[model samples]
Target chain A: MPAVTVRDLTRRFGPFLAVDHVSFDVEQGEIFGFLGSNGAGKSTTIRMLCGLLKPSSGTATVGGIDVGRDPEGVKRRIGYMSQRFSLYELLTVEENITFFGGLYGLDDRTLAERRAFALDMAGLKGRERTLTRDLAGGWRQRLALGCAILHEPRILFLDEPTGGVDPVSRRQFWLLINRLSESGVTVFVTTHYLDEAEHCHRLALMHSGRIAALGTVSELKNVFAKRAVVEVRTASPMEAVRALDDLPSVEKTSLFGTALHVWLRPGQRATEPLRERLDGLGIHAESLEFVQPSLEDVFMDVVERAGGTAA
Target chain B: MRRLLFLIRKEFQELRRNPRMFPVIFVAPVVQLAILGYAATTDVKNVPIVVVDADRSPVSRDLIGKFEGSPYFSVVDVTSNDGDVQREIESRRAWMALTIPPGYGDAIRNRRPVTVQIVADGSDSNSAGVGLAYASSLIAEKAAEIALQRRPPGAPTIGSIEARIRVWFNPQLLSQHFMVPGVLALLLMVITTVLGAMSVVREKELGTLEQLNVTPLKRWELTVGKLLPFGVIGIIDVLLVVAVAVLWFEIPLRGSFPLLFGLSLVYLLCTLGLGLFVSTISQSQQQAMMTAVFFFMFPMIYLSGFIFPIENMPAPIRPFTYLIPLRYYLVIVRGIFLKGVGLEAFWKDALLMLGWGVGVLMLATFRSKKTLG
Candidate 1:
């Protein structure tokens, strides 16, 4: 059975449709990534699945329990953590673990066992007495994850959990998430980081309260398969893009750092023509070559097609 | 039940670690009670008076002697000039002035009624009114005494009726006796209501409330867990302030201690409910504190008959006092402390307070939902 299944789940706030008829399914022990920018209905959908919000229409089931009808039953089977870490800053690491465990109604013996496990898992075994506020961002994030999973829940939902963390800590946090998934705990996470989305087995790119694309990384990259994306390195990328925009074969152009990626119409090749055109415009092009599209290209393309500004 | 215990334990742990909370909870009540206990009295004493003895006759001097002898009045200056009375009063030196007109002694000896003029500063109207009443009563007593003495001994005394006034509950009429219990009620309402609101809203500010909403904890469990600690603190404050009232102020707790404590518990339900209600409407601790103080606490104190008598309030506003839970609590607390009355005397007020408590609690609970929406 799937760990989570959402069908036409919609949430409305007054006249605003925050999550509009969204649907998806996550298999057991899979890392499902929901990618979107700020206010793209990522957090709203997570909240509904976690039983923290009621769906305005449709249904969602977490661990086989309907969220709208039996939110508490769904709550019992899932662990949730957010970007804030939500640990009491005044409390010690051990106390937070014990407190969350008690909240899940863990017995004394089980609480002691899980307490040691959480301490070891978060690398906080030796710093059990340290206040949560004193810990660095990485440690606090891990401690929060440890607290959330103290009940050994079958499903875990992380809402922008790596926000405001250093790159190194984010990588370390993802490592812990990988370990949990290896242990057969389904992980559902939302993030705007394209690089982090690479870690997920499957990803849904949300745009304006709707899923713009849902597939594996390679499958999503297939949008540029028939078309040609040529990367051109030039000193003046802005001038190069403007020079290539009027060409019949050129569909669109986007600046990629100092280089520019030019998209051509399907079954059309423009590498030689683009170089010749830039040379004609008195713009020096160092290199021009057809390259594979990255996830950032996919996100921009998806959002542009969905008629929303890309973040 | 166990989850509730954990939540309560977390709340207390947070409170202990908070540096400002310790002083606000444990020390502020004692300090406020001590300061307000001595400063909030309405008992007027030692009204300074400038006596103008224009009539240098023996009878006039004897009346001036009566003013000087009374404990209520201290003659700041005795002069023959009647104009000194206005100057002394305008300069704020004397609260009242007693002027004796010329030929005041002959009028009295002739058995004719003579009027003595008294000018009082009405800026401080409460003390001025009390001082005027005291002066007139003293003069009437002196007149009666002189009338009895001048008559021949056993010469058919005329029948007269007199009132022997006796003040019940407080014989000395000490304002502290009434004010101390009122302060106790006010302190409990301020502390518990503000603390309750701030505690919940603090969690909201820290984002922990959202975190808790995702947990399997029931809504009522969360409510009871969050507010039960403050209720405990409220009871402790009642005990502490009651001890101060009894030991330091010497205000009698003539009623049963358990009964007082029990009624205070019911009153706490109202205050804590108010706090919860504030949390539901506020998004931050600062907003919660503001709402609890300006919106809830101020209105309760003003309308509860704590400082101003509800009876003296405008007729239309007096009916609103019935809605203030503190109004019922003040009656219960003062009845216990001064009148030594039991449930038999204040059953109606107690029942009303309970009704308000439960109604407010239900309203607050209904508004406090586990779902974010």
Candidate 2:
């Protein structure tokens, strides 16, 4: 059974379609990754599912609860952490958790249990008495993640949860998400970090107003059908981009500082002939390591194809 | 009901958790009360003035001595030339200058009509008027005394001809005594209204309020929760200000303390409710503060019979003054403190405050819901 289901969900701010015909589903206890370009309707969709916003049209059900018919129950079943930091900065970690617990309608006994569980999970047991403002960014993010799931909510919605956290904290936050998913909590999250999508059980790439691609990491790479990513380091970055734009089997190309990452067609072997071609032009390219297409490459391929994917 | 409890509990937690803002919430009103109550006064005495007595005669000297003898005037400078008097008035060294022409004393002794030029600064009308009246009344009393001394025996005295006027309630008309009680009412408003005005705006800025809203908390629960903490602070501020009034200003609280507290609690509900109402509409704390200042500060101070005498206002404005809560509060405070009158004269004030409380609270709750919606 699906833990979350959204159908033909349309949300608008006046005439601007924030989320247009957005539809998706989260399998029970699955880590569903919602991917989108900025302003591509990810948070708007999450808000509708969580009952924070009433959709302009269509329907949503979370944990078998309808967003339209049973908003209050939907609120009780799901937890939301907004893109902007939402914890009480002035309150200490323990107090913040307890306050949220109270709002979630957990009894005092359950509240204590959840507090202890959350504190231990976040690895901030002794620092529970510390005010959230006093905590560093990483700890605060971890604490916020802890607070979001303290009620053991059936489904958790994280809106760009790791936008500004250090990489190490992001790792810990994902670890907690994985733990919760294993414990039967459905995790629906939106993030701009392409690499983070690799950790997701499945990814949905939304662009313009709808999902352009939806599949597992391997499936997404397969959909892109790219054999490998090869770095072309040349004297001039733009020269490589100009050279690769017309290159055969060049699935997608983007600049990373002075290096060029080329996405070649699937099963197209990386041969010395490519270097020979560059050498003939006197390009004197640096190391060309044939790497597998990461979610970054896959995301680019999907977003680029989004222009043509509407049909 | 359960969600309301949750919201209320959350509000209380936020209020407690924010240790830094706690002082602003609880202590600021008391401090403002203490400072404003003491500094805000209407009594005018010892107005410094330069006396330019050009007439170098015994009567001119005696008239200047009489001014120095009066408590209302402290003759700072005794100048002989007319230009010196202008200089004194120009420099603000004297709010007023009394000029006696060269022939003034000669004319008074010869029974010729004498004129003494009395000039006063008109900048600050209240204290200026007070000073002018005090000085002029004293001189008129002296004029009457002289007239009596010169009157033929068995003739009717002007004092007997004019009935003696008595001022009730405030006999001496000590501005401090009158203003201090009004100051207490004003202080209560500052605490209660400001607290309410900041509450919703704080929640919006803080983001915790969004959390509460997403929960199952009903509108009434949210309203009550947001109001309770500030309401408590308002009551505490009332007690603190009244204590200062009773002790420091010696302004008696002859009315029942419990009555004042109970009424203040109702008044605070309206005030704090208004604060929440302001918060709901305002996008930021700065806007909320400014809006509260403009709306509450002026009305409470000017229209509330706080700084001005309500009865003395124009007849049209007089009816409008009846709508200001402070008018009723002043009556209640004075009736209790000065007149030692209790509920007999105050039940009307109590009902007015109660109606305002319920009416404002309902509007606030409805508006808060609409804003969120």
The most accurate candidate by TM-score is 1
lDDT of 1 at B366: 81
For residues B40-158, could you state the per-residue lDDT of candidate 2 as single tens digits? 76667789988888898988888888889988889999888889877887899889888889997778777787778888888877767888887777677766766777778998876
TM-score of chain A of 1: 0.98
Overall lDDT per candidate, in order of appearance: 0.92, 0.77
In candidate 2, stretches whose alpha carbon ends up further than 4 angstroms from where it belongs are: A226-237, A247-252, A256-259, A263-273, A287-291, A308-311, B1-27, B49-65, B77-84, B97-117, B150-160, B310-331, B339-352, B369-373
Candidate 1 Cα errors over 4 Å, as ranges? none
Alpha-carbon lDDT of model 2: 0.77
lDDT of 1 at B14: 84
Interface RMSD per candidate (angstroms): 1.0, 3.2
lDDT for each residue of candidate 1 in A1-311, tens digit (9 for 90 to 100):
89999999999999998999999999999999999999999999999999889999999999999999999898888999998999999999998998999999999999999999999988998899999999999999999999999999989999999999999999999999999999999999999999999999999999989999999888999988998899999899999889999998999999987789999999997578887898888999998999999999999999989998976
lDDT of 1 at B63: 93
